[model samples]
Target: MTTPLVEMLDIDKSFPGVRALSRACFELLPGEVHALMGENGAGKSTLMKILSGVYTRDGGTVKLDGKPVEITSPRQALDAGISIIHQELALMRDLTVAQNIFIGREPRRFGILDEAALNRDARAIFAQMNLKLEPTVRVETLTIAKQQMVEIAKALSYRSRVLIMDEPTAALNDAEIAELFAIINQLKSEGVGIVYISHKMDEIKRISDRVTVMRDGEYVGTVPAADTPIDTIISMMVGRTLSNETAAITDTSRNPVALEVRNLRRGRDIRDVSFELRRGEILGFAGLMGAGRTEVARAIFGADRREGGEIWVGGKRVGISSPQDAVAAGIGYLSEDRKLFGLATGLDVRNNIALASLARFTRAAGVLDDAGMHQAAEKYIRQLSIKTPSDTQEARLLSGGNQQKVVIAKWLLRDCDILIFDEPTRGIDVGAKSEIYRLLNQLAADGKAIIVISSELPEILRLSHRIAVMCEGRLTGILPGGASQEEIMRLATLREPAMEVRHAG
Candidate 1:
C-alpha cells in the first residue's frame, strides 16, 4: 500500500466542561476524498480543528507525508500545506472577489496595489478552473454559492496538499453541488488529499472514498462508503437506529381550523401563499432551500412585513404587525436560526423560561414574583426533562437540544395555541429529535394547531399529518402522511405541476 498523506492517531482534546475528542484516529491518502461523518456535537469539527492547528491536541501524533510533525498555529498549518474552508463563509463583504481571495498577501507594485495585475492573476486562476465569475465583483453582491467557490479558489491558491471542506453544500442547490463535486474530482485527480466533513448522508455516499464515524467524542471506526448503509452510519453516530417511521394522525379534517393564512406575500421570497392549520393537526411545510417556506413563517410571525396577506386566528382575523401582535393573538413562531432569534443565550434557565410571559409572574407594585417564576420554570424543567447543571445555569452553556427545549418552554409559558415550528430539529441530535417529535405530537393531541417547516424530507414524512411542499414561492403539492421519499421528491422538484399532487402511494 502507498504511504498515507496524513495520519492523526489517538487524538485527545477537551474544553472546560466537554471532553470533545478521545482516541480519535483518522487517516487520509492522496487522491482520495475521506468523509468525516457524525452528528452535530459528535467531535468531528473539534477533531478537524485540532488537525488544522486551531486547537492543539493534548495527546496525539500527527504525521505529514509519513513524517511526524507538530502544527501549532493556523500559519504553521498553512505552511505545512493544509487548508480548511469553514462552514460559515468568512469573506469580507466590502472587499472585491480578488481582494477577498488574496486578502493577506496583496499584489504590490512599488509598495502600492496594482489593480490591473490583481485582476489578471485572479482571472487566470478562475479560467484554469473554468469558473466565469468576474474578478472585480464585490463579495457582498455575490450569492452564497459563488462566495463558497471563492473560498475554495483561495484554498487552491495556497497550493494546499490537503483540503478540508465543512458542510460545503449546506447553502447550495443541485446545480451548484454538481459544480463543486466536479471541482473535488479534479482536485482528487491531482493527488491532493481531501477531507470532507458533513452530516448529510447522501452527499457522503455520493462523493466519499472512505467513511469515519464518531459518537460522543469517541471514534467508532472507518469503513468503505459503498458498503455501509445510511441506517448503519446513523446508528454509529447516535448510538441507535434512526426511526424514519411515518406516524398517522387520526382524522384532523373534522377539527376546526385554528389558523388560516390567505394570500401571504413578502417581497420576492414569499408570494401569494396560503395554508390552513386545523386544531390538533400537525401540518408539515416542505420545500427546498430558498423556496420561501421560512419567509412565510417570518411574515406570519411579524418578524418581517408582508406586502399582502390576511391572518385569521380561531375564526377571527387578526393584525400581526409585529411579533408582539402575533404573540398576543396566541401564535408562536420558532425561527429556524434559533441562536439568532429564538432564545436569550446570555440569561439563565429560570430567567429565559419566564422571559416570554414575565407579566404573568408580576406581583404587587410591579415587582416580579420570585416564587411564581420559580414554580413556572421548575414545571417546564421537569416536564421537558431539560438538562442543566441547575435552574440558574446560563442558557448559552446548554447543548443545542437543551437550548431548544428552553425555547419551547418559553412559548408554552405564553400559552399560545397556534405554533409554527421552523426547522425545529435542525442541528439537534437523533435522541433529542425523537423527544421533540413526541412533544409536538402531544401538543397537537391537546388541540394546539401546529405547522412544521423542515428541509429534511424523512422528518416531514415521519411527523406530519399532511405534507405541503413548496417550490419557487408557490404551493407545489399537499400529500397525506406516510408519503414515500420518492413522492415528496417528485412534488419538491415540480416547478410547474399541472395538478395539486401526483397520484402516488
Candidate 2:
C-alpha cells in the first residue's frame, strides 16, 4: 500500500472550559479527497486547525510520508507541505490579487520590491489553475466566489502536498461550485491530497473518496463516500437520523400583513422592489449570488439608504431611516456575517442578547439590571437550545449554529415581530440546520413574520410559504412554496430588458 500523505492520530485539543477535540484521528492519501463530516461543534474544524498549526494539540502524532513531525506554527505547516484555506478568508482586500498572494514572500531584486515579477508569478499560478483572474485587480473588487478562488490559488501556489479547504463553496453559486470542483479534480490528478471540510452532503458524495465522521469531539467512524448513504453519514455525525423532508407550511393568508414595502429603489441593486410579508408567514427570498436578495433585506431593515420606498407595518406607515428606527418599529435583522453585524463577539451571550433591547432591562433608577438581563438570556438560551456553557460565555466561543441562535435570541428578546434572517444556516451543519428550520417554523406559528434570504434553493423551497425570486436587483417573480427548482432557476435568471417596447398608436 502507498504511504499516506498526511496522518493525524489521537489528536486532542481544548479551549477554556471546552474540550474541542479528543482522541480524533484522520488520514489522507495522495491524490485522494478525504471528507471530514461532523455536526457543528463536533471538533472537525478543531482537528483541522491542529493539523494546519492554527492550534497546538494537547496530544497527537502527526505523520507525513511515513515520518513523524511536529508542526507548531502556520509557517511550519506550510514549510512542511501543508496549507489550509480557512472558512473565513484571510486576504488584504485593499491590495491587488498578486500583492495579496505574494504578501510576505514577495520576490525581491536588488533589495527592492519586484512588482512585475509578482504579477507575472500570480498570473502563472492563475493560468495553472485554469482561472481567468487578472493579477492586477484589487481583491475587494472581486465577488465572493472570485475571492474564494483566489484563496484556493494562493494555497496551491505554496506547492504543498496536502491542502485543507473549509467550506470553500459556501459563498459560491452552482456554476462557480462546478468550476471549483474542476480545479479540485485537476489538483487530485497532480497527486495532491485534499482534506475537504463541508456541511454539504451532496458535494461530499460527488467529490470525496472516503469520509471520516466525528461526534462531540471524538472520532466516530470512517466509511467510503460512494458506499455510505448520506443519511447514514448524518446519523453517525449527530447520533440520529435527520429527516430530508421540508417543513410543513401552514396557511397564513388570513393573517394581517406584518410588513409591506412599495416602490423600493436603492441605486441599481434594488430597483422598484416590493413585497408584502404576512404575519405567521415565511417569505423566502431566493436568487443567485449578486441577485440583490440581501440588498433588499438590508434596505427593508434600514441598514442601507433607499432612494425611494414606502414601508408599512401593522397597517401604519413607518419611516425607518436607520437600524434603530427599524428596531423601534418591531423589526430585526440577523445579518449573514454574524460576527460583524449580529453579535458583539467580545461581549458575553447575555449582553449580546440584551443589546438590542437594553432599555427594557434598565431599572427605574436609570441603572442597568444585570439580574434581569441574565434571567432573560437564560430563558431564551433554553428556549432556543443554544448549547452554551452559560449566559456569561463569550459569543465568539460558541459554534456557528450556537452563535446564530444567540443572534436570534437577541432579536426575540427585543420582541421584534418581523425578522429578517439572511443566510441563516450558511455555515452550520445539517443537524443544526434542522433545528433552525424547526425554530423558524415555530416562530411563524407564534405569529412572527419572517423573511429568509438564502442562496440555497432547497432551503428556500423548504421554508418558504411563498418564494420571491430576484434577478439583477429586481423582483423577477414570486412562486408558491411548491415551486420546482427549474422554475425558480428560470425566474432567478430572468434579466430586465434594455428598453420597454410600446405599440405605435
Give the candidate number with the greatest lDDT: 2
User: For each candidate, how many residue pairs have backbone atoms clashing (under 3 Å)?
Assistant: 0, 0
lDDT of 2 by residue, 304-420 (tens): 999998999998999999999999999999998898799899999999999998998888888999999999999999988887879999998898778998998899888899999
> Which parts of model 2 have CA positions greater than 4 angstroms off?
243-247, 364-366, 497-505
TM-score of each: 0.85, 0.95
Candidate 2 overall lDDT versus native: 0.89
Candidate 2, residue 449: CA error in Å?
0.6
Residue 422 C-alpha lDDT in model 1: 91
